[model samples]
Target: MSKQLIIDFVSEITPQLIESKDGKYKFRGIFQRADVKNGNGRIYPKKVLEKAVAKYQKLIQEGRALGMIEHPPDGKTRLDEAAIKVTSLTMNDKGEVIGEAEVLVGTPKGEILKNLIDNGVKFGISSRGSGTLIKRADGTVVVGEDYEFLAFDVVYDPSTPGAFPETIKESREDKPMELTLETLKKDYPELVEAIKKEAKEELRQEFEERVIEAIEQKVSKIREEVKEELLSDPEIAGAKVAVEGILDILKPFISEGIAGEHLEELKEEIKNLKESLKKKEDEIKHLKEELERKEIALYIEQKLSESPDGDKIREAGILKEAKSKEQVDKLIQEFEESIRKTINEDKEPKGKGVNESRQKLSLSEIHRKLGLPVIGG
Candidate 1:
């Protein structure tokens, strides 16, 4: 099974914009580089980079190296938003893979992403790949050799902002140190405090909303219970019957006499009528089952009379033993077939009587009976 990994890095864009005649804003940037310890404390080894480079080159050659912005890195969710494409990839002197990509400003999402990039919104590129990771004891991970490079997506919500610099420095020492949450608080305490305040307020609002929802659910349940109790009360039931009786007596006198208050009584009467109908239906079903059973018994009796071995079958108590019409029919069929087989066996002829005659007399007895002497005596 292949695992997924997202490689987040800053794009190193050139100053000059490559203008196009088709009203698309095009810019060049190195989307990712290999052999560097990224924000996740992981490195893509040379072998892994080579595999990715080869796969990406094939994709570009087939014009299928399309990518998107802010999409899921796992490729679980699909959106038809191809905002970027890898143009070329090459390995530098330090065995690092460098790649250039073009952003298509023709798409709606691409146009928005382009506008953000132009306004210095500070986004990074994340390369999505399916592979296995080998974690070392030093807490650094390396991508496996069987890695498949999928797409480089533009990510706006990077975990560490300083990991992606707007400008690429010649040396690692020249780049700013990777920022931690603790380090960020120490550097910008006021901004950290504002974020905390906002988070607390948001949590408080969520808790309040949950409490209100729970209370509303409880209130609705209580109201339903109260309504059911009232409906079942003896006093309420008597009053409803009395009101219905009065309405029935006055219905003929008044033209539009049935008021809103009588609707409840009407509903109760309808409920009672439905209950009566349901009971009648159940009774009808039971009667139908009884009729079917009697019909099956009649069929079994008729078939038993027509059976050839009816006397033997009746003596064996097969009719009483059979619980259903199917069992009775099976027994009848078996008995009739036995009778037919016995009749067929009796009609078959016996063999010749030559052995029987020879056994009846010895050789000397046969000669005396025929008035002749025995030859071998």
Candidate 2:
């Protein structure tokens, strides 16, 4: 069916609410019923349907509870490492040695970080210990608690932590250099949203166009058959001659003795055919117009999505990238012609033999390559 006819049919089938403002393209709403078993089985806003499907998929994935992936830490020339230095090997209650281990955590390797922050290095320390009791039963000044082992290793690198470190460093206060969080968030949001939205809208539009096209084609077929029957009806033939007078039409027909039952049957058939044809014709008109409107809208949208500049994108000399009104119009014309050709070809009968089928296919291909819409003369 032609796009125009399909649009007319849909408009007739489902009462449409149409609104056209000066600055905006027309919007159409198709009325649908509620019963899940009825024809309105899957009526919903296109975006809403996609979101619902995505949400369901996410729920399923969550229910499965897929494990988190742990990729190997990136390899680096300067290692990020944390180490524990054994301070002192002490004897236990028996003649055993007990070694105390202490780990110090820091940013960058001792050498690497020091060089990066090229500023002068200033070190300050605070000691913690238990004062000793002595000297004439009074308190005595002490340098610090017995410094059994003051073991400190320079943090040349830092290793990522899984749990609390086994070793503990009882030491001074220190701070390391850090990267600010704001910088990471600022750069990626625009790119992410654009990709997601474009993909979603593209898929929704494709599905919708296919469904509308199918409905239009089916309705067109029904209308064509009815129209053919109506044009060939004998009652219509007899009606043309009846203008001469009732006696004139009956004189020739009475001699042949046409059956009354046959006339009744033909009348009934014509009535049914008329009703069916009218219904289908209306539907085809509605759907075809809707399809064309949607196609134009889609093309305009895609054109707007291209570069902000006015330069037309070159696409195999076809000018698929529409930067101006002229380009958009060209695309629409090309698409309509191609679609119409396909519909006409689909109406033809297929060959029976393998060789005949192959030849037919080859001819079809040649016609396509030549940019001609194949039709039976």
Candidate 3:
């Protein structure tokens, strides 16, 4: 395979362009991620990025994780015109490379970067690299282990109305290629998540019809078991006797001429009633989802409307992307488990006879008690 030139853009929103007190500026946010498709439709396995980030750290330590104000003529970082000095670079547990870069003062190009930022011009962080490209028959491009990290350039993101949408912009073809994390994720791994996501939402939308049907089938089987249990258990003899008496009365009617015809009609009536109950269950599920959504929107508006940096957080659209939200949720769960283990070591709590002693409450119960969505919808 031919060597490929790769450019992966990081969202300007994920990182803050902090204005330092002494007339300096720094950019900090996620620089890269592993085991996911980058903006270029290239997959870098966790191991691949783990190794790359480890090696790249050495360059950062050397103050050589340099980059220019803009992409150079042929995918190179000319140190003499370097505009950014990467102060720190490290990967998080989720395989995202968090980086900090300071705008260098007393440099011609660096001054230009500072000016653009002051004027509210946004810059997307993009990496310049080269590697062997493997095209999966499925149209996914995998970045091989031979992949290398060059400088993280500051590419200007046009903020004007007519500017290209971030989704479409990453798909552009220059001699060098650029990838937006959103586009590739949407096109590939995320595509799977997107497809299932709606069904899952409808599932959370409450008692999905297919799901209800499955439960009804289970209930039908359980009804026979209930009858057997009731007949066998002496402690419930009253219930068993009542059931037997009803059966004895129905037995004559079930066998006779006019009464047998009436029994068939009664069975049909019961079936219709069951169908009506199913529709009611479906309706109840929908109501739960709707109530949860409205409560959430109202709470956010009333409590967090003026939240600090909420706009940036929302605009960076990190949590809003959903894939990242899934990552955060997993990490949060892992952390909760770790904390529970640490605090209640060797001593069981009273309620569940487990650590933390917290009441095990289903989200639905919690939502019923408080005005909250039952779960992620």
What's the lDDT for all of these models? Answer: 0.60, 0.34, 0.60
lDDT of 1 by residue, 254-326 (tens): 5465465666676677566556555655655675566556556655656666764555556445566566778
Instruction: Find the candidate with the highest TM-score and give its number.
Output: 3
The candidate with the higher lDDT, 1 or 2, is 1
Taking all chains together, each candidate's TM-score versus the true structure is 0.38, 0.20, 0.41
Q: Which pairs of residues collide in model 3?
A: 39-179, 39-180, 40-179
The residue pairs in collision within model 1 are none
> Taking the tens digit of each residue's C-alpha lDDT, what string does model 3 give over 230-292?
466543434435445655788876777647757767666556555655565565567555544
Model 3, which residues run further than 4 Å from truth? 13-23, 158-377
Residue range with the least summed lDDT across 10 consecutive positions in model 1: 166-175
| Candidate 3, residue 297: lDDT | 44
Model 1 C-alpha lDDT versus the unseen true structure = 0.60
Candidate 2 lDDT, 1-377, residue by residue in tens: 00000000011111112333532111112211111111111212223222323333442344321111111122111224423222233333332222232222243333342342234332211111111111111222111111211211222112335311312332242223232334212322333345468779899889867866875686577567656755676444334344335446555665687644365565566566556656655765776666556555555655545532112122113444445567776664564455445445555555454333333444345346437554442
List CA RMSD, all candidates.
33.5, 31.7, 19.3
For candidate 2, the TM-score is 0.20
Q: What is the lDDT of residue 299 in candidate 1?
A: 58
